[model samples]
Target: MTVTRFAPSPNGPLHLGHAFSAIVAHDRAARDGGEFLLRIEDIDGVRSRDELADEFRADLAWLDLEYRDVTPQSQRIERYRSAADDLLAMGLLYPCTCTRAEVASAAVAVGPDGPLYPGTCLRRGPTPGLDVAWRLDMEQAVDLAGPLEWTDERRGAQRATPAMFGDVVLWRKDAPASYHLAATLDDAADGVTCVTRGIDLFRATHVHRLLQHLLGLPVPVWHHHAVLVEADGRKLAKRRDAPALADRRRAGEDGRSVAAELRAALFDTGISLSDIINQQT
Candidate 1:
């Protein structure tokens, strides 16, 4: 059966952009009579508010999105750690103590996420007594995985190029797992057949494909839809303090009507859910 998930971090309240992404995933699974899963990606340590998770569920409920399963990253730390250990045993992971400021100052080239790490710790090794994060040895990992590819519903087949991000972190000193490791493992564990998320993360799929190849995980088809943006053209984000969905709910807006409006806005027509799925498939 087809499966899809809406994985949200609980650092802030749900916004319209998040609603759009969640609705897309929920409807995609519904269209195929498949399971829709919700995952709380709350591994950011103290920044992750426990209460926001409950709020996320309420918001989704308000939007009439029903998820059959839910997984919280906090409960899966051991799994992430085991995956890191396996990579380390395979000589694919190395310890790093580089700080963001240090990396930014040393980096010469930029990648999809931003200024790529310059591999200072990869060259120097972790400093003694300093807490260290684990980074993937991208060159070694890609060499071991060999040439790889993953498919996207919208973009078609894509050649995996994880090297563009250089040696990305897999485990963080402050958290059990970096997003690259945790999200990849969680999707495999949840049996997500189709990964539906925003297009901003489309590049990260290259790294995820390599992780799947290395870890012997099942690869999933992806659908990266265009992100909701503000009038200034900047994508809505929690850090930027995007308008919260809770505000609309408090103001007594009709949730289903709001959802329908979002669907029309995103698809650029009054397309039915089945029509959207048909066009993509």
Candidate 2:
């Protein structure tokens, strides 16, 4: 059976972009008679709000999106640690003590995510007492995994090239696991056959595919839908304080109608949600 998931971090409130993504994942599973799961990516202890998880559920309920199961990363910290230990044992992960400022100063080239880590820690070797983040040894890992590829529902086949992100972090100094490690593991653990998320993460898939190969995890087909953007083309982001779905719900707005409008805007109208609202007004 096909299984799809909508994994949302509870660091902020859900917005229209999140609504569209959730609907896409839920509808895809419903169409295929598959299970749709909701995973709360709340591992970031610093930023994650415990109350936001409940609000996420309420928001989804308002949208009428049903999920088969819900998994929270906080409950699976041991699993993440075990996976990281396995990678460390295999010599695929190494401890890095470089600060963001240090990396920025040394980095000469930029990668998909940003200024790549300049291998400062890898060259200096592990510092014994200093707290550290664990990074993947990309060159060595790519050699071990050999050639790899994953498919997207819309984009078709893609060759995996995880090196573009340069030795991405698997474990953080402050968090149990970095996104690449935890998300890949959770998808496999939940038996998700189709990963549905926004296109902005399309590049991150390369890193994920490599992790799947390294950890002997089940590979899932991906569908990276177009991100909902503002009139200026900037993606709707919580950091930018995008309008929250809860605000609409509290204001007596019809959630189903909002969802229907989003669906039409995404699949049929080829227009922005603001444009649809403008026309209706």
Candidate 3:
């Protein structure tokens, strides 16, 4: 049986990008007679809004995207902590104290997600009793996991090169777990057979594959669909003032018709998954 999930962070209102990804995951599961699940990735502490989560449910219902189980990351803190503790014991994790500004000032190169951390904090050693985020030592982790690979349903098999991401945070300073740690752990726990999301996250899979290997979790194939872009060729983001799905709903637009249009847009552009991964807005 195939199991897939549409996990969304409730930090803001759902937008077109969120709608496209959620619809794809829902349709994919239905086409394969698999179970579709919904996850609330609300681990960002105070930044996550409960009201936005309710709005998300309403948006799903408006689109008629039915999901079986709903899992909230906020309720799974202990699981992430345990996983981090094990990695710490294995010496694969280290404490990082660099602020965003500090990391950007010190970074030498830019990766898919902002500037690559320069590993400055890793050299300084741990500051006991001080609040610090736990980072996975990517070089050590890749070496320990050995050669790793994962399959993508749309893109075929590929080797995992976790070093491309540098040392990613497992436990965040403001949150119990980072997105990579929580999403990877929850996917395995929920028995997800296939992972589906926007192709913008294609690079992050390298870090996720390594984490799965280190934690001895059941690996699943991935399906990274193309992301929704704006007329200005920029990726739609809540922080960037993208219009909310609620705005459309409030205007009394036909939910089913909008969903159908989105489904058509998925392949109408003749854009490959690789193109989506490589094209930077």
Candidate 4:
């Protein structure tokens, strides 16, 4: 059985980007005759909200995006912490004391992996006495796994080289855990056999897959589709001008309409919203 998930953060309202991702997940799960799950990534307590999470759920429901279960990231901190501790105990992780500015100054931005480290801190890796963000010791971990290939629904198969995504952080210095750690742990715990999201995350998927390998978790199949874009040719995000799902609902646009718009805009499906809902089973 292919268990897929729609793991969206509850820090903001659902927008068009979210809609595209959500529909892809829901559709692929149905097409494959598998289970669809909703995982609420709300570990960032400073920005995450109960109301926003509810709104996300309502939006997915309105879109008729069905899932078998719902899991929240905040509810699984212990698991992520356990994973971090296990890495720490294995000498596979080190405390990174570098600040954002320090990292930006030290590392060069190569691609989606963010920075190609100059090994400034890796040379002084694994500070035993201090509490700092835990980073993976890539040198030791590389021999275990090499180039990994992921199959995409739209763009086809892609490979991630170690040169691109190396020694990514398992936890942030100020934060208890990072999104990468939390997400991979939850996927394993929830038995997600497949992952479907936007293509913008293909590179990030490499980081996630590397984490899964390091953490010794089952790697899931990936299907990344094109992200929905704004009129300005930018991706839609909650923090910006995109109206909240609540606002759209208040204005009387059904979930089906939004879902249809997403399909038409991104996937080029020219179908009436009402007809799309009627055709979906």
Best by TM-score: 2
User: Who is ahead in TM-score, 1 or 2?
Assistant: 2
Q: List the residue pairs that clash in candidate 1.
A: none
lDDT for position 50 in model 2 = 88
Candidate 3 segments whose C-alpha is farther than 4 A from its true place: 268-281
TM-score (C-alpha, index-matched) for candidate 2: 0.96
Cα lDDT tens digits for candidate 2, 3-32: 989888989999989999999999989998
CA lDDT, candidate 3, residue 231: 65
What total of clashing residue pairs does each candidate reach?
0, 0, 0, 0
List pairs with backbone clashes in candidate 2: none
lDDT of 3 by residue, 88-189 (tens): 999988998889999999999987778999999789996844588888888889889999999988889989988988888888888888889999999999
List candidate 1 segments past 4 Å from native: 127-130, 268-281
Which is superior by TM-score, 2 or 4? 2
lDDT of 4 by residue, 1-281 (tens): 88888888777777666777778777778887988898888777588787777787778788878776566777777888889888878777777777767877877665465665556676865555446677777766665567666666566777755446667788875556876678778889999887777666667876677777777898888877776555556666776656566676777777786677666655532223333234433
Q: What TM-score does model 4 achieve against the real structure?
A: 0.86
| TM-scores, all models, native as reference | 0.93, 0.96, 0.92, 0.86
- Judging by lDDT, tell me the better candidate of 1 and 4: 1
Q: Which 10-residue span in candidate 4 carries the lowest summed lDDT?
A: 268-277
Q: Scored by CA lDDT, what does every candidate get?
A: 0.86, 0.88, 0.85, 0.72
Candidate 3 C-alpha error for residue 223, in Å? 0.3
Candidate 3, residue 131: the lDDT equals 82
Window of ten residues with lowest summed lDDT in model 3: 272-281
